[model samples]
Target chain A: MSRARNIEALKNILIVVLFLTTILLLYFLWENVTMKTFRLSSILPAGSSHSLRAEDVTRPEEIVFSFGAGGVTADPDVDGRYWELWMNAFQKYCGRGELLAEEISRAQFLQLTDYRAVFCRFAYDLPLESFCQQRGISNRGLNQIACVTEMGYSAGSPESVFLYDGRSGRCYRLVSELPAEGFEEIIRAAEQGEYLVYYGAASLFGAESSAVLPLNYSSTLAETPCGAELGGADDAERKAIAEQFFGADFGFVRRIEESQGSLIYMYGYDQKTLTFAADGSMVYREALNGEAGARRDYFEALQDALDFIENYGGWREEQGRHLQLRVRDAYEIESDRQKGYRFVFGVGLEGVPLYGGDGNLLTVEIYGRQVTAYRRCLPDGDLEKWKEDREKEAFSVVGLLSEGYPAIYEALRGEAPPPVPPEGEEAPQEGAFEWVAARLQNARPGLVRDAEREGSLRPAWVLCVDDCDFFYDLYSGEAFGAVPRQKD
Target chain B: MKKVIMALVLVLTLLCGSCFVCAASDPAVTVVNPQGNSTVYADNILISVKVTATRVLKITVFEEKLLNEDGSLSSLDSLEALGQVTAGSLRHVVVSPAETFYSNGNLSFYTKELKGITPGIYKLRVTTLDENGRTQYLQECYVVVRPPSEAKALSFQSEQSGVLSFLQSFLKNIFGN
Candidate 1:
């Protein structure tokens, strides 16, 4: 009787297994019959990668508006609402531009961007070829300067367009016969928007200076929800990105877990090894296995890098934040694989740029015809919505330094303040602030992500002084931290 | 009752701050802060004024003492005027009494910064001159100062409808802000 009972149980288990197999088979058959174009391999990211245009990759870092006499304003919008409208309209005029001047006088260039003008600034030099392609203009003799660091259009002088090359500090001019009604409309809208137009840097110190001190101590700045981070992510949660990277090959990819919660995934014969570090950074390194296919120019190489970025993970636009890759720099580098260019990018939210601890969103190395390396360091989710908050006060360059004054004054001066009246005195004066402000190479507002805090981001003013980068809270004017300035 | 009255006055002042219009019609000069005899705790004050005189030629901005030492609020104005912010050329981020300021053409904006003042009621004066060298318009806003540590609230209460903004900035001041 016992044997019979055991046999019955075994028979029941087999029947259940058979039913499961049949259901799976039926589902597969149904899928095949209903969706002929669908295949398991089609789900791979490389098969239908994200597609983007050259114009989408290279964008201005800031849209600086000179309102009145030395009243410059950079308005940070929640969504990149109308920046593209201005940029696209500005590009339409560049196509018909005729070479006006190779080298514009310093006074002339400053005059163009000084008042009633719109200056589109790039964090790094924009390749002339890429810029031309982006605007759909022929590269032609536009190579007078290898790169365009900044460009502008003065409503006051609609007949002429200004181009700035940061490398040479030389300005170029382009003349167009087209009407500048588009730019005028954009400018009029921004002007009428009632932006907080502060006294410009030129008003505080001198012309063509980036250092700015608030002329009015009681003035206020706005605070925006910059960026966000994910916390308490488990190993499986972090490995999810690795799976997307491997795509069709994810099943076969060898995943090696490292100490301190690091994850490494090696794809087929060491072709590519991706690392997800504990610091929420992801790096993709392609092994130098294939033969040198073909050498290409920077433009073609950039396209390839963009293609790879889309295939693996898009600019996170699908997430609805309109996140785009704003290229900060392009450098000629030689790796063991081959000599190629490295494109460094910072993630841009709408039009505003959010810089990380290292201020790098992504770095891709294109060797010959292939992308040899790629690095990504951002919060877990690209399109994260920080809690909605109203605008807060922004810290001025002078105010920010004042928060850490005297303490940093000694470091800034490399000595104590001279004794006034009696001995044992180390009192800094306005002159000390003036001294530091003069040395400030540049100051701009953006969001800062603290790497150690797992993506805790805050709105801050990023300042470069004496080869160092300092971040101050946008509202409280408190110092977040400072790191060595990364030379482009 | 005294604390409640002070709170109520502060609330009213902040609500009406953005559109504070006191001067005459010709130039329409409006003061932004230190309304008459308002109390504040800050190291420096900005003589920000809005003028409607389109034909203004020159504008001179400065500050003057409104109260003598040993005044009621003067004792509370114990903050060191010559702060590092002035010394380092850095400006401190001071919460404005007004919640929201909309700019059209009447906004003259921030014109001058006055630093290193001893605690007392001080007057921020803006003298606007027309095409001629003569003074065309003048704006004066009086503010009382106290030590930063003596302040009771993170910021003044506003009647403006920006409740989210008020809560955001206030929470920022008290929290990990």
Candidate 2:
């Protein structure tokens, strides 16, 4: 009986041990499978122990500007003779040497009616305050300013100066005097108001007094001059024509009687019932006329001008020329679905003259609510020379300034000015390269020297040199040469 | 009888201990792709994988590799080996998931243009590890190449007079021209 009991006990112990072992094995197998399935590190390779150098990386900043031309006046006399004095003054003030003169003399300039200019300024590195101070300006609320100055020269009186602030959309008559203290005060006040002042008289940098005038003053004339030719015989006929052409909603707002026999009709349009001309060849103000609505629509007219100059190949060719004139027929209209007020002008290819000397005389017609100006060029004359000169002038003023200032060029190259030495202390003996190398070597031991001599190793060293003072020429026998001492 | 019992107990203990040792030796995890031979372009090729786990799975795309001279996987510090594309070259992609048990889920490789890839065989090796830090899996796959797509043929065909005539007639009918 004792022997039987011992055998039974051994069997039970064996069964228990086997059961425990099986359970443990199952747990281990579960763990192994779970771990194997979940593992992901194998997909990628090991990262390099090395760090990136400065020369191996670059950061770029891109800039874009949107602009529009507000109002344009086509002044035939806007030739080099009128701008020569101001151009000279600007070149002298800016210390631009003779380069401006050389460029301006060869530039092409055009005279067009209703020629408005819009300036967009983009700058880096220089603070806004410093930029304003340098331009003899002050800033108001907005980050940017637009100034327009128009000067009209008559046979007798001093040039009538008209300066308009884009921010306020108000015109200010500039007080003319030496030292121009009034102009300064106006600028200061405008700055305080955060106004963008527009000066149309001359280029922004030109002398404040000198201005460019429009060729045709008829548009600016207060009233129709007496003795001016009248297309229609009676007022009823004229009004009928205006109503028919300008849409039934159009009405005559005012009629000015001038000394000449000319008849002027100022027509108005309800915001809802206007149409823009198909081709954008005319000035914005003419297109707007009596149309009313949001100011942005007026600004769109300026944008259209910019678009025309930038996108239209023909207008660009005619810009800054005096002789061969191109005139556009003006049309006014409300925007598509009344997106505010919009206007446009159209000019035909046959209307533009190849040479300014062509004996063709131009005529401007106002039909219903529309106005079209036509001009003919004379064959064999100084118009071609005038166009070339005007173009050259325009290019010299705006083109160079837009490309990039000298400071911008330096910044683009990643060139920085040398650091100043500490006060009352001698400058360090080592150059930048040497100092950088020493600092790097101290920070990381033998990393600069131990990299491979070829291929991938070359870039690593180049990066080290860029970040540190050490110079490693991949070309010469000297692999890790220290920067040489500068000669006194 | 006492000696025999002692001997039996010792054998059971040894057997149990050996079982534990063997379980430990077996890989707990398996990796899916490594060497990034899963040919992909820079924009689209995403280095990722399917991780299986016996215990718990942890997978990651640790580093990226470019083709070496021997056509085997080699470490690349930069993408200079891809050479420049006239417009721009798209090559080399590296990505890693945040958590391990991708019980959280699987990762995919996204590439942009397959045409940019050179006509050559490529391999992708994936290394997988278990929660215990044991290497559980190393998986690799060979990728084949086909010729680049030809868009010029379509353009040429589009310029044919027959096509133009068909298009014009269709347009006229549609518009009642």
Instruction: List model 1 lDDT by residue over A382-459, tens digit each.
Output: 344442444444555544553454435465567974322221232333344445555565566666776555466666
Share of native interface contacts present in candidate 1: 0.01
Q: Give per-residue CA lDDT, model 1, range B2-104, as digits (tens).
A: 6566555544653455322244323344453334556544455444443332434233322322233444211223122311112233222223232222233
Best by DockQ: 1
lDDT values, one for every candidate: 0.56, 0.26
Model 2, residue A12: what's the lDDT? 100
How much is A335 displaced in model 2, in angstroms? Answer: 9.5
The lowest-lDDT stretch of 10 consecutive residues in candidate 2 chain A is A98-107
**Where does candidate 1 chain A have its weakest 10-residue lDDT segment?**
A418-427
Task: List, for all models, the DockQ compared with the true complex.
Answer: 0.02, 0.00
Off by over 4 Å in 2: A1-337, A340-488, B1-119, B135-141, B145-177
lDDT of 1: 0.56
